[model samples]
Target: MNLLKKDLADGISFSGEKDGHCITCLEGKQSRNYSEELEGKCLQLVHSDVCGPMSQESRSGGRYFLTFIDDHTRKVFVYIIRSKVEVFEKFREFKSQFENQTGKQIKILRTDKGSGYVNRDFKNFLRNQGIKHELTIPYSPEKN
Candidate 1:
């Protein structure tokens, strides 16, 4: 620090470790705390997400899989599909089966703002069924 001051920076003052531990270091020693919210009732809230165009397809030539999760029961349902177009069909199938088994209609459907769930047909179906559709904040997959 003294060498640089003499050779280049004559006007600027450079302090080398003047204080003790930094603010960042103090914070880094602790873990983050997240607030907890109330969980919904069974079939009252459902989350759906789609993953794929996998490198290898399924035996039926499916390239994608759709997932549905129940918030209250922590139940998960999955369907293998050939493409994004099959999302609606698969969702309908899952909804029917789940409703039949649980005797409850899904009240809310939460999903990312992906094309498969954002299309017109998907929204229309949700509306017709009187189910609320929730899109997670754009660019925040953690919300999903």
Candidate 2:
């Protein structure tokens, strides 16, 4: 273990040999990757995604989950939904509450453009509100 090695180098001791082989540690290590910089103002950019139809439903009978992340603040809001159709209503609620509380308008929204998000009604709402929609390419969720 690196901890044991550091302790030994620092003059700590143990009576017996210590084995360092760890299956989980060897399998779990990951290298860091580049990420975009944060936004300059709260509500300037928001990212959203929906994950759903889980094999096992939650106690509340919800099969989908939605998330909204404020790019500036890195604050996350999560909600459980019964189905993907709830995404538009949830976004309306999120936008209303977030804008009212923070006294700032959401200028841009980034998402993966799933059926839940790319509907005509949803696009109309964004345009009506003067909010820009940025859809990520398929298979590139990190773009959000």
Candidate 3:
């Protein structure tokens, strides 16, 4: 503003508004919130969650649904399941099939700290495949 005044800005001037905040300057310093996707490469990160025990079951007798989302691409894969036990299997299948199809390995997985994902079998599978698992705090659905 001082430079503009000294160098002759024709119609724009801050000469009288010298004591308060400058909206333009403040806005210029702000930035968009950073997303959880690291480096933004496809298959780099995934988010998984299960929503189930629904009141109305699907025609196939599915009582639950599992979801797998690619953080970078925002691609979503949903699986209707008969039970929560299917979560681990569905996740494994999703990982294998997606990796094979894309020719890229998933480096990380993010999920809520639910039993379906935190069980011994699920932990073993993730460890064996070298996939990092990030768990949202329990009860904090917003973070998930």
Candidate 3 lDDT, tens digit per residue, 26-63? 56668654343333588888888888689999999999
Of the pair 2 and 3, which is ahead by TM-score? 2
Query: Any residue pairs clashing in model 1, and if so which?
Result: none
lDDT of 1 by residue, 1-144 (tens): 234425654564544322443344455567533112222367898998888889999999999999898887767888898998888888899899988866679999999998889999999999999999999965565676
> Candidate 2, TM-score vs. the true structure?
0.71
Stretches of model 2 off by over 4 angstroms after superposition:
1-40
lDDT of 2 by residue, 1-144 (tens): 664555543554534443663344455575433222232488899999998689989999999999999987788999999999999999999999988877779999999969999999999999999999999975576887
> Which regions of candidate 3 are displaced past 4 Å?
1-40
Order by lDDT, highest first: 2, 3, 1
Specify the highest-TM-score model's number.
Answer: 2
The whole-model C-alpha lDDT of candidate 1 against the native structure comes to: 0.79
Global lDDT of model 3: 0.80
Q: All candidates' TM-scores?
A: 0.68, 0.71, 0.70
Best by lDDT: 2
